[model samples]
Target: MRPRFVLPAAFSVAAILLLVSCNRGDLPGKKQLESEQVQASPVAPVASSKVVEELPGAAVSPLTVEQRLEDFDYMWKIIEENYPFLEVNKRLNGEDWLANKEEYRNKIAAVKTDDEFFRRMRFVLSRLNNGHTNFLSKEEYPWYLNTYVQAGFGYEPWINVFQQPNVLARYNQKPLAEQQSPNESNNDINSGEAGSQTGKTSGNVKKVIIEPDQIAYLGMRSFEGSLMEMDSSEIRDFLIEVKDYKTLILDIRGNGGGNSSYWRNNMVPLLINKPITYNTYSLYRGGEYAEAFMQARWLTGGLLPIANIKDEQMPNIPPEATTMFKDYNKNVDIVTPYQSVGFKGEIYLLVDSSVYSSAEGFAAFAKGTGFAMVVGGRTGGDGLGTDPLVAALPNSGYVFRFSLQMGLNSDGSCNEEVKTVPDVEVDPDTSKPLLDQPAIKKVLELAASQ
Candidate 1:
């Protein structure tokens, strides 16, 4: 319930899938599947009861013929019941999701090994074309962690500068005569600052660099650890330090995203001077259990005591719950800016397709409020959905996560269908380091402009 997949750490091949596998609605008793299950409304919950009954954590093992079939059935049923955007996704991608499931289910019996089974499972998930929905075999998880988690450092310009001395020299050795040229603007307040000030805060914010031009750059790799594990005071102090810069560049390229609170509560307030209303409405399947989960999550600040509750104890769902299923018609969240000493200088947000989930949410807020000029490629369009619920397959030990609510922009546009477009779209140059990339240069140019 702690805002599923809120950080870039969750951006692993398996991680994104796992974070989005679970239903955000409720852990209800698995209902019987309808003939046309995909078209059914208020799709049944994945059998929390079955999960509790079958696996018991001791019985789960590698794939057997029967087990593989069961796993396929389990995965398909759960997806059919809880996948939030089958209709929209079908329309957008022109893929027959239900038909794909049936096709994949037939192939399950032919799978000879766990690896093959995993491939088939992945194929089924891939048909959704959703980055958030995914599955990872137990064997694949370790490799995923090693490859993605260890190599999670994305594009950080300041880091590139130190790692490549030539890049530093290019920026630093610009002629002093040129620095004082009549055509140059005096808007760069701390132009005399000598070396770049670079350091990683305990809060996962790496490389806070104040260049000689007084353009402050803060590089954040993932938002997950920084907001939850670190102290808010650290964030406040970091904001206080960078508040004096003439221009601030928040680099979140390749940022997988984390908890929305990290930006909503901590970052947004520091960027905007006034309160702004931003909408991120979501639609969940209507049911008593789902309603209870929604109400509980809202009341507890995104936490739900799912393990403690039984179906009978679920409160009666409100009559309005029926109307809530009208996709994109949900109420708007009028978020008020947090009170703090915020930076009112020119702001730029650096992004890439890897920026997703909570990170994408930050981009949406920044773009929607006009708080910052976005620069870089389109952000990963993964925010327009509810945080997913995770479930473990009883037979295969593979975990699956998926969203249960479709998220919408303030104007009721589907984020899954439309990515967050940057004001200045500059693609990264893989041939050079991040600091030497054209995007960073463009950002610096914008920063230097009067």
Candidate 2:
């Protein structure tokens, strides 16, 4: 445990003076602020932010000096070079991680054991408050308990404990899984900690007939597997059946992401006759991770934005950060190779906070191109980039993973920050059971209106 030291009362006056000379035109951070008038301040303001900085966790065992300086330095270099969400997290969560480089290094230098280093690294990631990135020291560090599969089952116990608590909630500040209601197929898939394996190969789209042929519904429980890979005619026949429906509601409320290829091959070819496109943008440092990701995806085109994307919520790209652009015309449009029957009627995507990764990517594609009317709640983002990149500490050999790409939309807003917004916002009626899916009624009403 790190000791908390309150400065003497007399030192408060001096601390205020120094802070005012420093802090300029910035919003108040997570610290408790008391408004006060400052004297002899010209260039800067906001004197009351004389913060009692909370220290990160300490090692349990006593260890040698200079324990892991090189290992930490290597990690810091990678983060500095590639990570794009640093500024976004700072503005949103009030965590200026780059400013506290030495503080984290000092914590790593005194780590008594390998376990302590892992814990300390997790604390470092906690400061970022990101769901896509994490220090994967434990095999199941990200497991969640998703009980929303059925009617009687309620929320998992840990939902009240860790997921999206107050930013300054000390040790509880890590970006825990934003777990929510899951499909029966995704009950074990999302609730990974409970040791239920709803892996890709088995889970398929469940069909629900809302109003016979007039209004149809399909529950895309998880994008973990391909409709083509299962060697089944069920998904194929279902798509062929609903391809001509007047209005189709694709429910992805509890769909946790798996593979981009799942829908890329299955849904896009069969449903999207006219190409659905969005201006895709990416930020990267041309590191090994970026090279491999681009090459693996066979990404072939890019150009700089007309102006350096200036958004208040977006990251202020450093001089070293290169903006990579993707042409949605070629990438998202798949017609010549795979002939699309294309759903002629209106397609409405049903989403909630639980819709994430490739699942959220589907919602984004639908929303971005006006292919589907996005209904229900806003989606979980961090969906536009490739899978996370992994690296190992040279000395300790402890491996971890983090996101290297910061995907953006056409309007220069970050997908990770803005997420996928609904065209028709309908809040889920939490009073009802999870299995009831109360939001669908309003979504259907709104869809018919439009």
Candidate 3:
């Protein structure tokens, strides 16, 4: 168990010194103020980004099939030796991982062109159960991201975590068996029950015909990225007139991780300005312990104003030490001071096993701040701080993202193994789409009743 620490008493918006050495030519906002007072200091740049360099004695891809196999072997060797987690081997144990690796090799080896080889490589990486593991040549990552964005289920991008649908389809694999029907004529097939099963192959899209009086729902997938960038304004507009609905369902199901600022910038406006201490940080030993900083209680400044952090004067500390203090203070810094807003509406947040990383941080914060009711499944087993550190593999030139700093929730509990358990436990129906699930239906029903 990790020892707990409260955010030091010295931490607050008010405690932050607003040092301004202004000139008439200066502009408004935090950056300008800081620039006038102190020299701009950027964080030490990461030296190792992903690069594509030819390996020694490696065949330049227009090589024979045997050479392609050797290339894959070299990449796997790099992953085995350099992967940060010692237990990564356990996850890849048994014939399954090897079988997939061979399948990828075969596909690549049989490819007639470079495009086909790239496609095979993507298939290989996709099989690696997604812990920031990948097979992209850095140039391909952006395209992959764009491809994923294009494959959307709806206007809002999200994940589908239903297991029953997959299991049942596998159990009733009629399509796989239908190809052996050489004896049957088209008319004969149409007369049989198998024809009816064909229509069922495609999944159903459920529609929730919500009334203006009925409760409206919005599920936050995660809280890490820029809230303004996410279609939050569309959600915000929907929420603005949400008083018509008796209840609001905000599902955080499977949302396990993200930054706290995502909440302060995006969510606070929708609710009553409840002044709550969200979370605190405890630096690891050997880290700098600095003077306290604080900000005063302020009103909703929208996204722009809230993000506008004014500069502070340095306390004449050492150059290196001063820079370290600034970096540490940025994460622990409370840009918007605590204040109150009166929201008369009720809110419910649905949580599930996928809620992890920064999503878990947001959930813990929501619970701590009394912003919403947490309902549904338990979170993905991760509730700690993680500062992403990237490392390049010496042989393959592949980049690996590793967690550096551990995070502590407001209550100082880090559930790396057990995860954040939901307050309301409801099993999701995997056989049905999320819109048709019992939990979402229940939320709507409750809202209607109210």
Candidate 4:
């Protein structure tokens, strides 16, 4: 379970829109986020002893070449033993990562200093091409994991490193907490004030008029968790009004996911009455974090555990003979229509490369179930699975992280690789507003033709 979409309990995204404002270019590393320091502070619990602390101007012979090689082997071993995307990566990239053992070792052996080693490690992990699996700055891990806890992942933190609510406020970088919001203007629709085809809803929701009563628009910026205290009256009123429209445009671009449940609970039910079903399979290894997350009853039983699988979904299954896959039991979610009249129209989900994690989950559902006609660019995948697990290099105290589960679509394809393809593709015009992008314009034309 990758907690990229999960967070600690105290977080609140109780509005209509998905929230979180990370640009695709801004994420750590795009996964390797560093602040160009010789010695970054590695947190305790994961690494406290023998940690070659990169103190300010302090000379320290961090690790011998042999020790560094051992640490490299440790990193390699854990990923080989537990990480689930090896086969999928091989199938998608046509490059077998596990087979590159000697190649990676040679690269690791050449890096002399701690900084060089860290940079080399980044190059090695980046080969996976996964957003969630990367070497994390220990300074950023707590906030990233806390993001999962608040997003309602419902897991016990095994390492005890994530106790702060800093919300990725480390590295002396601008905090993402302050950056997590979509563009909103006064007279937004959710506010219920008079407006010229535009108004704001709470949280990540925005509404606009594309064709008045015939066409309406809604956008969710992120899927942050637990909107427990938001007043329902405004949202319900908007939903009641939106239900009369002929079509709804559901936008989830730049929605770097927080919690999958936010949409499962808050946005989905109101608009959907009949069941929206899809099959999602995942590969995982039994570890402390994965087991604890499962034991907490977070899975809710749609995923049936299967072992020693010889299937096309994961053709290059992990080298580990005992690796396992959790086959989804065909999840069927039926919700009572909001006010007995869900949106009496079609839904078109707008997407782009920025759509990821739980948002990609939403796009997957739309694509698989035909619940919504997806529009725009392919998504930035990694939508399936649980929150990520963190560990540190014993020698250098360099922390690394990744999801325990590798999610697969209804078909055998890996979610992280295939992503969600658009039904009606259109290049978005960044110069225009979300409501008036080229995709929106194309969708408008499509709706007109209908």
**Best candidate according to lDDT:** 4
Candidate 2 C-alpha lDDT tens digits along 81-120: 6677787776667778889899888877777765566566
Winner on TM-score between 2 and 4 is 4
TM-score of 2: 0.64
lDDT of 4 by residue, 1-104 (tens): 11122122212321112222122323333223333332221132221346554321113345678877998898888787677777667765665878988988
The TM-score that candidate 1 achieves is: 0.62
Q: Candidate 1 lDDT, tens digit per residue, 136-213?
A: 333223222222222233312212222233212312222223334311332111121211123223445654565843
lDDT of 4: 0.58
Off by over 4 Å in 4: 1-61, 148-154, 157-204, 226-237, 285-341, 433-436
TM-score of each: 0.62, 0.64, 0.45, 0.69
Sort by TM-score, best first: what order? 4, 2, 1, 3
How many clashing residue pairs appear in each of the predictions shown? 17, 0, 32, 34
- The candidate 2 region of ten consecutive residues with least summed lDDT is 14-23
**On residues 1-450, what C-alpha lDDT tens digit does candidate 3 reach at each position?**
001111233224321111100011111233532232221110111123544422111222344566556656755554443332222222332224544565567666787644344344434543332233433343332222222222222211111111123211322222323433322422221222332334321111112225555666665654523222333344444566664566767766644343334444445544654344444332221221111111111111211221122232323222222221122222343323222233466777777766655565556555656677677776653344432223332222333232222233444333333345666668744357766887777666656566
Q: Clashes in candidate 3: how many?
A: 32
**Top model by TM-score, which number?**
4
lDDT of predicted model 2: 0.51
Q: Which residue runs of candidate 1 sit more than 4 Å off their true CA positions? A: 1-67, 87-94, 113-115, 136-203, 208-213, 226-228, 231-235, 285-331, 337-339, 394-397, 429-435
